[model samples]
Target: MEALDSPKLDEHSQALVAMNEVFQRQRKDYLANPYPDYTSRIRDLRKLAQLVQDHKDALARAISEDYGNRSVDETLFAEILPVLEGIQETIKHLRKWMRPERRRVRQLVYPLASNRLIAQPLGVVGVIVPWNFPINLAFSPLTSIFAAGNRALVKMSDRSPRLAAFLKRVVTDYFPREKLAFIDDGHQLGPEFSALPFDHLLFTGSTQTGKAVMASAATNLTPVTLELGGKSPAVVAPDFPLEVAAERILFWKLMNAGQICTNIDYLFLPESKVREFVELTQKIAHQRYPDLQAPDYTSIIDDRSYQRLWDTVADAQQKGTQVVNVFPGNEGDGALRKFPLHLLIEPNDDSLVMQREIFGPLLPIKTYRDPQEVIEYINSRERPLAFYPFTRNKSLRDLYLQRVMSGGACVNNCLLHVAQHDLPFGGVGHSGIGHYHGKEGFINFSKLRPVHYQGFIDGLKPLMPPYGEKSRKILEFMIRRARS
Candidate 1:
């Protein structure tokens, strides 16, 4: 019994030892050369871009194999292209981001004293990558990490074994193990990964797992940026064309089989437009994906996720909700784990479909009579990662924008806000915390150290220790000046 347990314990211990070794090497490397110059940082970014460019085909294939049949185009568009473009944008702006900001000194010491805020790297960062959009999530954060002159150790999801193995094999050629490393979750090293003493951690996954990761990181007092998912909604205004709304919503909803965190989990349509909206969405789905088993259609990640989606639809149906198969007569191949897109009409709040994030291709839509009803119902729940309100009216758009708070939002579109390199992406409340992307990403991975340069003459000399008539007069003058 002891011998049998010893091997299991040894396996776990070996995983821990490997992770710790890489972490220590990175920490030591960062301390030795705390700040990497502009040229070196640019070199790192170039290497990253080149690596993806060289392996674009293999990377897409690995991701496709991991998903059982992830569309090659989807992988390229959603994952590869965005990351490549993001790296390019970061390279363009990194020099400006690295410069020390000269802050205005107070009037009292204006002449000689100077204030400067420098964005300095914060040692090594730990990244926990989710299986969905693995390359984008991992490399996007890495772009920020490297731009801020820090090293990183990324943990790959267990579900993406093929991609993880492929990345691990090729990453060393681009970056030294001491500068960057990828840890596979094959040994169930997620908990161990988060528990390490990293300067910062960026996790992109479910909200439930985010809580555990945050708790584990708290032990080391490490800062975290959690990009968790929630029930993000898209509301179509009465003025907006149902045909256009259906096309945009369904495109994002069915992309990657709706595995996106910022995907439209639920939708709100005007009470009068429900039937017409459903019809338009059905037509659009049929047109976009005629064959559910085709490589163009992505499979649900694994057996558990595939079954969860089926169970969700069953639960909704049992609760007396209308479930529509977007592509009728195509139930998808169960063995291949392909799942057809579903629309749950008017699912109750208590039902599983409405209660959870609905990470797959299931879209639960509710009918709304007024904007207030839509606003009230959504605001009553946890703040979502994204909110989409399609309207041409400026007043209505502004109202929705001001009233509905989310991690991010797109006015007339969905998921396009995230595609923009200049905008910061993050969540609020239950959705997520801390913004990262663009300048925010650079700042989030860096420490803004404030420095003060002393003047040739001490301004406080007159106010020093001894309380006398002259000191009192000076204090009075200073107080009056401050008030003025």
Candidate 2:
């Protein structure tokens, strides 16, 4: 097979010109076939699934190369599996989701009238995928976009160069430019990409970048779904065992080296159990990753990220925050870029680690005297992408579920909620906007157009513009009935 040419980054204007050409082609194709049949949609989804399956090993290797040493298991589990599962789920329910929903007609328009909602496909969707979990972030949303029977144009993050290049080549080989295309521009073309007049735009990245995408999208008044990340918190109820909390939290935190958007950014532990929780987390870390330099433990994505994590920890320590390296002895060689998990205990509010989303193996543990304090503390900050509460107590779990506002929540678990094909995954407030998973995802890329059918007999003739005494009498009767 001939190698696909990578996008040139000589000039931003030239890149935009190329990007717009692709977008227009997709738009034209969409116009040709606005609503695809169930069979056609299923074919598209299945083709995508098979493409992923065929390239699974290659994609994993490219991702690992991009991250220096990302574990194959992590890529398979966090990125590949979710996408494959999501594709199957979409295939299973596409027919039902495509069915028009019957709605009730008002009494006034009752005679030979009916209402229904048609899930019409938006013309074209633009998806901006982030670096971390690149495959899942790109393909997961693409599954929904395809399920909704729309064309798509994806922009991969420049940070994951190898994966981006690999996907650009593979996607082109598998899909037509008008049906599905990938843009792997290693330049400052983000502004231009987001500025396109797409039917719908979905972006997954930092809160600051999300804001810029939203701003650019405003020019076209394009509807957007911003999956932004923030300081997602995990609260360990006193009733829950420290061991369980530590184990579950470490699983997510250590995954992708804690680069996940939904990973617990900080922990709210019961004040008395703080020390014990730390020890338990350390023990769990040791058991899971006995050697820090092992391939199972993912390395930091790049030099910039490695330095950022180090700077965060150093700043916290300087501000009188207690720093505990979970694996103290085995500081992997600098070449490997594998940094052990660092626990920041009670980092000051002004500390960098506490203020920013530490997208690394640095975990900040905050203590709360009362569960209510935990609630108040979490609420005081911006709502996060996810909230995890490890509690077996029904009342406490319900309390957290009701009180704490997050994009999504998991009870007694971490990060599994996003994997559920039936549930919608999205963030709230600063975390994200809109949802995309299962039926909700299908709806996200579709315009739920309400259609009404009426018989030849005009039911509203009595209430026409040229109202008379008869119309007044009918209005009076309706008012009396409403009042009664």
Candidate 3:
């Protein structure tokens, strides 16, 4: 199926020209008035926030159309609140955050050298959003971009052109096309969008696509924020609440129909408690949403995703894995995209569900005996964008936190770590590069300038004179003393 796209989008060639002009203009404009000067920048951010705030309902409505059936309530809380909150928080903290950092003077130039770290805005930033959680994912990096006082050009996913159009309208109303523009297009434009020589780039999507975006960003050596997805996993200890854990996990697991980047893709349960956990999970999911494929229930994002969910279930079933359907006729004939709520059982790791990420409602339970076995299981795969463990036990949580590494993790819950605006959000290995949200977000979009102001006493000035025994001895003495 073709993805939704705006008819108003400038064709690739024309879009390229517009962006280049904007980049050059903004670069000169920014150079003329460095970002550290807050008047114009703060004015711009307030305008942008007002624009977004005024159009909140329209944005949510458009997104609901694109997703076929999206949760407007969830979108408001997850997407809109976060973006506005980011703006508020950034405004409150920007002055202190942008203040120059002081550094210790080196002994070699103790009296002569004064060191400082200055913050500078990385010029134009490019942000590409994914269809799922479009506004939150899109505007999130905007927080950092504004915090660093950089102009931005954004490209909203064509899959959600309705929402893109809504954003494009609001943004254009408040921002100059040069200061901030939104490009709405499909696959034909992905490569060219990535090729822009923005000072920084942030692309949020699949791991495979993130690689391509990174490669293109490298053409200009632009640093990239790759918020890529991997099969993020959740582990449930034997001591945790089976019913509550299953309910909470399945609640979030199914949010946006499991299309979320930080969504728990797979689960590892305590070996001895596998049966109990599965039973509870099935009961809760059934009770919560008896009609799993109804209009209110979120459908697969698109047909390709629909087929993918189908394939995962089909392959697992064919491989002799038990596919449980708690609701009568939950599993369909595979004709319509409303396939089934698959409580797929892969008693062995070799099954299809176990082989890759199930970015759908299908939950495959993998059992682990030892706590170390769970850690080893996590280590075996590429690092996840988000790791979740549901255990109230402090010691086990601490042990897991120290041993297992992920982009961001939660002990008693899943993915909520990302919602906390105070923590830095990012992945470690295969999930992502660089951090965003809170303080790290500000740094990610900034160029940290290491500055050293130097003036000399006559004694230090002699060290820079013609190579003489006195200078050499003085340098040696400084080096030795510095090392000591």
Candidates sorted by lDDT, descending order? Answer: 1, 2, 3
In model 2, pairs of residues that clash are none
Predicted structure with the largest TM-score when compared to the true one: 1
Summarize candidate 2's per-residue lDDT along 379-429 as a digit string, tens digits.
999999999998999999999999999999999988889999999999999
Per-residue error at 401 for model 2, in Å?
1.3
**How many clashes (backbone N, Cα, C below 3 Å) per candidate?**
0, 0, 1
Q: Which stretches of candidate 1 lie over 4 Å from their true place?
A: 1-9, 109-111
lDDT of 1 at 315: 91
Model 1 agreement with the true structure over 232-305: per-residue lDDT tens digits: 99999999988988888888998999999999989998888988977888888878887787899899999999
Comparing 1 and 3 on TM-score, the stronger one: 1
Clashes of 3: 1
Best-performing candidate as measured by lDDT: 1
TM-score for each predicted model, relative to the true structure: 0.97, 0.96, 0.92
